[model samples]
Target: MLRRALTNQITRQQFRFYRVNRSNTVINFVPQQEAWVVERFGKFHCVLDPGISVLFPIVDKIAYAHNLKEVAQDIPSQTAVTMDNVTVSMDGVLFYRVVDPYKASYGVENYGYAMQQLAQTTMRAEIGHLPLDRIFSERAQLNAKIVQVINDSTVKAWGIESLRYEILEKGDIHLPQSVMQAMQGQATAERKKRASILESEGERQGAINLAQGQRESIILKSEAEKMEQINKAVGEAEAIKAKATAVAQSIQMISEAIKHENAQKAISLLVADKYMDAFSNLAQKGTTLMLPTSVHDPSSMIAQAINIFDTLTTKRKDMKSIEASNEDKKPEPEK
Candidate 1:
């Protein structure tokens, strides 16, 4: 009985040691940005976070180990028809991360594969809604829409959070040869049209500037001519006024000289000399002269001139007396 009792005690000790070793074997040192999904007795259990974690040797099992870091999945190239009925083949990348390990492990067969397929389908659907031109121009908006669609479909169902979607650049989309040629032609025509418009605008502006310059020049020239004409008119008027003043002064001096007796004798002798000189010039010209029948008498001609001068003086005195009488006959202002 004592030997049997001792044998049982040793078996119990051996069982305890095996359990310790088995538990040690199941211990996990999880790294950062990782999660381990645990199951107990083939049922869902708690998730093992980063750092040291222990599990029941037989009851607990690491069902799925998920990396919490973001993942970039390449979408396979596929052809899709656009709204305008043009076909284009395209490929891109999808960025995602596992947020809930529990759902990621059980929600879908494979979350990464599901995300890739969803992204591709979403891209094709979006392409179908847009024309070929819009597809190329609206890539950013297309990517954002794709990301939104993907997250909406997979966030709650697959525990996958789509960070973003990006269509690769550098000719990722392949068009038909005919489409490529057509697009090239269209681009060339657009550039030519813009160049022609710009050229025409430049010529129009240049013509306007030239016209303005010519107009200004003509206006300035006319203004200068007008000023010259005004200056000439003013100078001519001043000259006429000066000539009138000089003539008036000479006439007054002549009248004063004729008022003296000696001056009258000197004027009569000057007239006789002028009459002889005139006859001498006529003889030199070899022209016939008509005389008053007293042609040889210088005294007769001087006396005739003196008599004409006295007659003109007598007429002037008579005119002044008549003017004075008319002035006295006019009515005066009332006192």
Candidate 2:
């Protein structure tokens, strides 16, 4: 009976030990932007998200931990041959992010290394298709092509998205010394050619503008001269018209005065006075003078002058009577 009691005590101790072990629990604290992959019996069971996660201690295991963040990878310098058979060394950077944790874990052994190799190979292949000059000029297009090719192969299978690829700046692309020297000379020549063309164009435009200015100046000067001549002609014509009007008014006044009875006597006295004035000034104006024989006889000279004036008046009256007779003889219109 004592042996049976000892056995029962041992069995109670064993039950207590099993119950204590069964009460134990496993808790995991997951950080932000992280994914913990759980495997049950060597197979994927579930993914634990950020926060508290409980797992069975013996059966559930965290197989892989993945950081769900964007990453940038630097590409190492490598030599590539262009289609024109020129060799160049270049380097760049790549940007990417993990979209699916499970696929990233299981799709490839090492996605980062895989991506690097793919980028290098793609870059070389693209460079091979272009000439050296075009390779530099079309760098943006080359980067886009590389990204497209990488994403095409990795997006679904590897759960990695390639955001962009950028080739490094100036010093990243290295050419041989001889090639660089030749390129520099070519660039210098091209710049000189452009400068010369611009200079010639400027000279041509300046010459054209100068010619146009001269033409305009000539046209203005000719117009001004023509206007001057026209103004002078108009002034001369106006002077002649005014002089003719004054002469006509004076002649009309003289003709009316002559109709008075004492007009002839007044005219004789005016002729005598004009004769005396002309004879006195002739000695001061000139050394030589031809005087008529009757110059010493003032009365005789006045009588001669009056006779000539009366003869001219009689002829003027006869001409006016002839003009009136001619006007009367003209044929009238058959009104």
Question: Which digits, one per residue and each the tens of the lDDT, describe model 1 over residues 85-181?
Answer: 9999999999999888888888886566567768989999999999999998999999999999998998898888999999888658999999999
TM-score of each: 0.60, 0.67
Global lDDT scores for all candidate models: 0.83, 0.83
Clashing pairs in 1: none
Q: Model 2: per-residue lDDT, tens digit, 50-125? A: 9988889889877777777777878889999999988899999998988887887789766777777789899999
Candidate 2 deviates by what RMSD?
14.9
Candidate number of the best lDDT: 2
How close is each model in CA RMSD to the real structure? 14.2, 14.9
| CA shift of 192, model 2, Å | 3.3
> Candidate 2: lDDT over CA atoms?
0.83
For each of the candidates, give the backbone clash count: 0, 0
